[model samples]
Target: MRRKLTLKDIARELGVSISTVSKSLKNSEEIGRDTKEKVQAFAKLYNYKPNNIAVSLKNKHTKNIGVIIPDIVHYFFTTVFRGIEKYANSLGYNVIICVSDESFDKEVINTELLANGSIDGFIMALSGETQLKNDYRHLTEVTEQGIPLVLFDRVTDEIKCDKVLLNDTEIAFEAVSKMIKAGRKKIALLTTENFFNVSINRELGYRKALEEHGLAVNENLILRLPFNEQIDGIYPFVSNNEIDAVLAVNEIFAIHAMGILQSKGMKVPEDISFIGFTNGLLSKYASPPLTSVAQHGDRMGELAAKMLIERIEMNFVEGKEEDFRTEIIKGTLIERESTVN
Candidate 1:
């Protein structure tokens, strides 16, 4: 292996002190422009990369924000990350992403890992286990230390901080209404998990819409798994039931429902028109294109990043730091063949 290059190497090459090389690389005003340019060129030629960790230590900024999620492989979360990465990069910042895989203990450890100046702020969605455990002392610890944070999607009301959320209840109502309009009468609600307030909000929307349409709300139709967990039993149960249509709380359950229904000799749209939320990539690529509630994931991410950055700047300035701010991003309906008339 080749020996790595360093600032000392640049200093040796430039016939100057390492301190001069340091100030020049940092673009400090004390260094003359000609000298600074010469040092920078040498450093670049030698492929000398400044240590971000050292830079962060000196400036008290990682220019890196922490993001915690249950799973990065999920289509919805991936889309959200795409949005976040784009915005974070455009603003000269990086993201320190961590996955807890729905483990409450893991989430706490990840949050604590970022607390020691490793991240300037945080933008995240709560892990499924974190919500179940309902332990938010870690979140509050970051906030109390004056670290900026913006919670999105799976945020809890217990934590008093800035948040960017979708109008889950309204969209849920619309999903149900769309199914009804498409001539599907029995719309079953399938959720992946149960502890999230957002999921509850979406379920409430389903009920509110069903009631508004003068349709009797059927308790038997709502199937919530323990811990809001997913199960293979749902496939056969859905096949045996007289379910005409389904309003999956999110895309994963919705796509899975379609497969289960088809396996039982049911044709989509002809047998049951469906509408899934999240407008995730899978929804568009499903055997039959899925009509969906396009949760502006990119918009959610941008909004969350903007909020956290603003809060960080605020805390760095004004010093008022008393009240927390709350905000919501609106979701849109994306019509597709899943509910074709």
Candidate 2:
């Protein structure tokens, strides 16, 4: 009874990255001739066969792109989808979308389902639970199996794939600095746990802005809310804190805080100012029209799609190797009625 060899096993045996083993087994020119021969010999000696999904995908052209997002209800996700569909369709391809609902299990399921000969490639954002667990084996498996994958927004470095990102830290810094310049002495951050990369970056920006302005970084002023918790979950923190301004990581928190403040007779931009991360519908239509850092989800999606399509078309030819790229899109600070004029 012998076990089948996997990419990780081959990589560990050869003292190389899983990506290197994958490319080598595919006979990519990116791998040195010596390494490629060694890897191929090892694979043959161990009876290693590529995953059926990857083999099937490579043998046929589905002309369908699969996308998995954390939440479809989110304005940012919807906008990104629009951009992906627009670009993919223009190139004579269709898209299949799945919602992970912030669950790691769902993310794995969606990816596996899509990979089973249904789509040509994948574009996704990491789920909250996936980030919390810090487990990217499912994503890694897809890549190791020679599937083209592109990650956008909530991405992790553990998976070597093309990524589209927002300059979240820079965007948050600018938004927080705006509040500080408006004389906000006690600014606070409303965010999720540091497990989420986006939240962590925004928190960093928040801290950087305060420290650069000679303001003390108060640990107590930072509130980490549960992901997608009810609006009421944020009430007690805002009620008890003396925060003159708040930098929320998303529109949900920012809009919820605004309602809570108004209910407590605190006027926006008068007693407490706020700036949120996403410049979506809520930010634009909220009472007082929330000031926001407009992360261009559409542009990120377009770029991500473009990258994935390019990789898919490359198709791992004998003389070609994929060079993964990470594209960072800058955000714009949209001034509105939520902040002081």
Candidate 3:
């Protein structure tokens, strides 16, 4: 079977510019008849197919960017959107936002809706369902067309493009180490399923910290919860375990577990120390407040927007190959009333 050929491949093989190949394929008047024939014949021989989305985007420049987030109500996602909008607007670009609501189908539909030559590029976080399903055909389609995409926070390695991420493992290790230093031995990890890349890294950090501190990682203490749902099993999990510290992947889980434990006569930082990710309003306003990791969503959004815009502009440059990048933002742990100092 013949390997699929792209515009770049055809241009390189025919010793012509990609723009010339693109125009020739469409029989544009800009190309000489002889050159057009040569290009067309080569393409026909290779069974070359043009990506309609790529053709439309390369033919016209759109000063619009599309951003898709998993949930609109989440504080972290909202902050990230703010940063993206702020940076994109400063560059004289309009931003269109879409909420995936943690659904894989919604994410795919949103990508299709925006990839119709409406936007120059896309910035998105993988939806929970998208990660769970581990299918990234929609993302791969856009990238295959040479469209710029930047995934932040909830991201996957299946699709290769630019990405902005938190140093989840390092920060999680720091958080767990702090709890261990505070004389908490039986540390519990409350996280989403391992399919989510961020959760997987954080869990690695959690286990690393426990092992490094001479504490055995107890499987019973690890509670895997469903993403974006009201947690139900926290009470039973806590009641059944002798946990001295809890590390939740997000503020929602930390706050919910703390509230439940407090109602059960547990004192924050004394009976059990609690720490979660994303230092949002819930972390600040929760009873006794919660010590949390600041994921710096705003900075992540700004970086993602910057990368996507750079890629979009670079597409116009002749004969340049895409150089993908992954930018990591360091997270900070905020001390609060929930954890012992």
Candidate 4:
């Protein structure tokens, strides 16, 4: 591994004071133009990246944001993360990423750990299991200690913080309405997460759409999907359910639902229609091309990061303000053969 470059190395090489090198690199106007130019030239030549931790300790700004995600392996979260990182870099900031893998304790611990003097703010997406308890006291504690936060994806309205969320229920309502208009009466909802606010909102939308069209909302048609689902049983579950249409809370779940429905001697469009969430890549090449709810994961992350940074910059330069805000993005429903009748 290459050794990390430091200020001392730059100072020794350039025969300048350590303060001169630091001020020039940090773009202090006090340094002479010719001297700043030379320092910058050397920095670029050596690919010297300054230590943000040390700078933050001295100047009270890390130029770094901490990101806490439930699962890094999830396509949606990763896509959002990419957007956050892209925008953060454009604004001259670095990212400190941590994964909690749906554990509440891990989420709390990561939040506390990253809220140290190392970062100016935090952008966090809560884990699935976090719905059971609202021990958001730790998050509040971070905010109280003066670290700005803007939440992403799995946000809660009760927390009194800024958030980024899909207009999930509206999209669900749209999907259900479209399927109904296409003449599919019995719509089944297949979801892996049954407890989160997103899932609950989706179900409410499904019911609202059905009610608007005078279609009966049968509880039996709605299956409570458990986390530990079996791969092979997917086929039998769809076959035995006898559902005419399916709406999924996630894209991967919807894609597999289509496969299972097709395997059990059931024909899509003619017999079943599907609409899933996230608009992931695999949904594009599914056998019949799955219809999906396109959650703009990247844009969501970027906006959340932008908001967090704005808050941090404001708080650091001026002072903390009470007028925090929220952002809710609309989800688009993309049509495909799987959901067409």
Any runs in candidate 3 off by more than 4 Å, and if so which? 1-59, 228-230
lDDT of 1 by residue, 103-131 (tens): 88888899999888889998889988889
lDDT by residue for model 3 (1-341), tens: 86668999999999999999989999999999999999999999989997655655767967889999988998999999999999999997889899998999999999999998888899999998999999999999998887889999988888889999999999999999999999999889999878889999999999999999988888999999866564887878888888889999999889988888888898998989999999999999998989999988889889999998988888888436557899999999999999988
**What value does the lDDT take at residue 65 in candidate 1?**
87
Worst 10 residues of 1 by lDDT: 225-234
Considering every candidate listed, which one attains the maximal TM-score? 1
Prediction-by-prediction clash tally? 2, 0, 0, 0
TM-score of each: 0.89, 0.81, 0.82, 0.88
- What clash pairs does model 3 have? none
How far out, in Å, is residue 123 in model 4?
1.0
* C-alpha lDDT score of every prediction, in listed order: 0.83, 0.90, 0.90, 0.84
Better of 1 and 4 by TM-score: 1
Name the lDDT of candidate 4.
Answer: 0.84
Alpha carbon RMSD to native, model 3 = 12.0
Q: Which candidate is the best by lDDT?
A: 3
Q: After superposition, which runs of candidate 4 have C-alpha atoms over 4 Å from their true positions? A: 1-50, 228-236
